[model samples]
Target: MINGISIYEILTLTTILFFIGVYGFFTRKNLITILMSIELILNASAINFVIINTYLYPENLQGAIFSVFIIAVAAAETALAVAIIINLYKMITSVEVKGTELMKY
Candidate 1:
């Protein structure tokens, strides 16, 4: 437990967040929503990494380092995904996943 918050509680929160992201990914038809869901999933994992590392090996920085890397990658991914979604919107006038099929030859 860290600061009176049990690791199980934190892990449970991460699990819920991850499942919400999964549910959103499956149910949302909009590309932007899908991207946001992906971000949520990434964030949950990053949080899990940091929390577990802090609890299991307080002296080691590997968990925190990996979490930072995950955040950086997620930022780049969001930027690239947003750019793609914008271009797709311009071409199809919609950001729905079904609209992307029109781009295929």
Candidate 2:
């Protein structure tokens, strides 16, 4: 047991979260839902890094640093995505994937 939680348990939870994110991204039609799923996936990745670093190698802070970078990137991505979604909504008045198919104009 590392940090009071088993590594196996952490891995299992992360795996489950990753799959849920995948399912959400693929099944949801709304742009906002897809963005939520992407965030979930990013969170799972961040959790995995911190857990592994805390358990396997407590001497260094590389994992934590990478996690921070990932979070920063995610934030930037979210901001840009939301902006694009807003623009698309203004153009078509819908957030559905099908509605974006006409963005060619």
Scored by CA lDDT, what does every candidate get? Answer: 0.92, 0.93
Question: What would you estimate as the lDDT of candidate 1?
Answer: 0.92
In the range 1-105, model 2's lDDT, one tens digit per residue, is 256678999989999999999999999999999999999999999998998898889999999999999999999999999999999899889999999775576
Candidate 1, residues 15-94: lDDT per residue as tens digits? 99999999999999999899999999999999999999988888889999999999999999999989988887888898
Candidate 2 lDDT (Cα, 0 to 1):
0.93
Per-candidate count of clashing residue pairs (backbone under 3 Å) = 0, 0
Candidate 1 wrongly placed segments (more than 4 Å): 103-105
Per-residue error at 55 for model 2, in Å? 0.5
Q: After superposition, how far is residue 2 of candidate 1 from its true place, in Å?
A: 3.6
**Winner by lDDT:** 2
